[model samples]
Target: MAALALFGGIGLSEQKAKETLKNEALSGLLAQAIQQAQDICGSTLDKATGTLLYNAATRLKDQRRLGFLVNYIANKGVSSDLQLNASLDYIKNHPVDPIDTEDFERECGIGVVVTPEQIEEVVEATISKYRNQIMLDRYRFNMGLLMGEARNELKWADGKIIKNEVDLQVLNLLGPKTEADLEKKAKAPKQKAATETTEDKKESEVNGELHIAFERLVGAGSARGGESTNNVPPATATATAPPLMIPSVSLQPTQVSVPNFPADESKGFHTVPITSTIYIEQSDFREVTEKGYKRLTLEQSVGLRHAGYVISVQRVLRNKNGKLVELEATCRKSDMAEKPKAFIHWVSNPLMCELRLYERLFLHKSPEDPSEVPGGFLSDINPNSLVVLGDAMLDVSVRTAKPFDKFQFERVGYFSLDPDSTEQKLVFNRTVMLREDPGKI
Candidate 1:
């Protein structure tokens, strides 16, 4: 009875195992079969079911079952089909061979049976496709070999693989003209040297003309009897003097022909009549030394300020229009008795004096109060107002002058002292708006 029980147990376990296999196989087959049906009907299989079947096939390594399902789909032809029939056919025909048998081998010492002629055709097509693709997606393609891999895996014939030197020679023979065309394109064009421009030619001509004029003037002045004399002869006698036999000196102005520059109307080419009015008046003179005394009228004082100088009005005249005009006015430094001291005083009390004068005339607060005046009148002066007049007049003290120097001209305005100022002359630039409010102009 024990032996009988053992046999029955074994039978039950075997039945269970068989049932499990049957269930698994059926489940897999059903999934694949549905997908096949969908392909045949030219419609998509339910996504979840299709994924289950694909995953099962991969996990089980059941290539035969997968192949069978693919065959069923290829049998049907329709527009909405997945169009995977060719790929399926490839897998069915080229079954994976057993490693031990060595069923797969290279045809001509290479990995595939592709012929040289076929490779050449594929290479040409691939090169053309890649060139076009490069133009279309240059940035993406330049990123790396990933783009190339994608293109190659698409089964688009990439190009001939010249694994050996002999294959390269053969390819060269196939397209000899290509190399020649490349060489022709690589050659650079020859450039001609530039010729002299019109402006340069005109400058040369002007220099030549000036040289000739200078030589002629020198020769005429150096001729005999042209020496200076204190006594002046009568004009008639000088004109009638017997033809002086001055030595004949060969003086010929050299001719220099140069190209003329073309006229350009864009360069300040305009003509307009400019009319100027002048008035002259003779009047009496007067002088006053009293402090706080008005030296000139408001209009005259404004004119003096505009002139950027201290001028003494010696006379006043007016036209029929009731305008007080000044004439024969003499101007000298305000403190001419001590020129150096005056300069120092001007530098030290620049803005204060100007502001005082402005306030007295315009009935307005001192302009310096807002900008220069510190916390109070007793406060320190604005450091920016301190001018180094010593360095400023250095240029004018010497015969040679350097480049212009910009300085805060004390209280007046920012000035760019002109380098053209020599020992005999001095010039200063009044860069800021003379009036406090420019809009008033």
Candidate 2:
């Protein structure tokens, strides 16, 4: 079942992987219950018996006595569906822990297959045997649920882990319960400290069964995930205690580092960094080669800013022609560590330039198909693949760049001054982008 349903595809995204893990854990719990029921019914298990046992334990919510019911019903004259229904109705209302096999057999007018001692043994083995494993499964299930809830409320960058303030509220709430549970038994609420971060306060407010269980496990330092319980001091009833943030969680999936550039793996355009210089050959453009020149869009200039390139626009006057245009400018190290948001390398004199951005070179046969081949694949080519940014403004620093000189366009792509560039006009052709720096191309 898992092979066909769980792994139908080749690769799984982080979210998809989490969902599969959650479903597996849930199925494991249910399967464990089925095995426990079958143990008491011996080697003659049937579909009807299995369905009844599953419904009684899960849907009816009778976790305590499913084993006894199985033993009493399966070893008797209750072979008919009518008799089975009557017996199940009786078991659902009665408490099985106190009933011995002799009484159960008498009530059903049939001798029990498993003895009373054997029933006791099965009960003990299945009920408390995998308590720890059950707790761990519950933890995984709850984490998956919380992540789904948080994702709806947060603005997450693609491929980034949940880290924003709103999502942190859900993460922090993974403690045993609400913040109130952190206090020692019978203790008054602790006073909030002036130094507490805003996050510390929010975690204390959300309440749920999962949060309470999480606190219990972490507080005892027995949680399977090794989450920290020492952050907040246990509350004492007799004295005033200091307020602290809820305990920290270290879910297994959360520990792995998020990839810098996550792409649609089904396609072939893997990420490659832009380190060297590239020269744009206008002759290489599909339009210039096959047709005529096309105008660039101003929206493309706005899109570049989102990719981490700080393009500055300043009013400047041309010395020779006295043309009025915004001096388009970019700093070489705008993406460097510890740079101010306002920092940019602006030039007094602006240059008339054009930037050509390229998308995937080969056409995909279908959205699901990954092959990008030669002749036939060209028919599936994306016409809007390349974006041209003409009528652009550039800073004076670009004047120093030769025709072949390459400059990494921060988060954008690698570009070189066009060979067709002259004193009157400048052009740049994009080579390849480093990564999928979100927002726009």
Tell me how far candidate 1 lies from the true structure as C-alpha RMSD in angstroms.
45.4
Tens-place lDDT per residue, model 2, 1-441, is 442232222132234334334454323433554565446565345645543443333332344555555554445444433344445556666754575656545655343233222332332333234434423342232344433443443212221233222122222223223234333444434322212111111112121110000000000000011111233211100000010011112111111111111111111111111111111111111112111111111111111111122222222223355632222222222233222222111111234467677876432425234232211332233333576766544433355456755543422344556798887766767654544332232
Instruction: Give RMSD to native, each candidate.
Output: 45.4, 28.6
Top candidate on lDDT is: 2
Q: On a 0 to 1 TM-score scale, where does candidate 2 land against the true structure?
A: 0.24
Q: Which residues of candidate 1, in runs, are more than 4 Å off?
A: 1-31, 38-56, 59-120, 125-441
- How well does candidate 1 score on lDDT at residue 438? 20
lDDT for 4 in candidate 2 is 25
Where does candidate 2 stray beyond 4 Å? Answer: 1-348, 363-375, 434-441
Inter-residue clash pairs, candidate 1: 123-159, 351-411
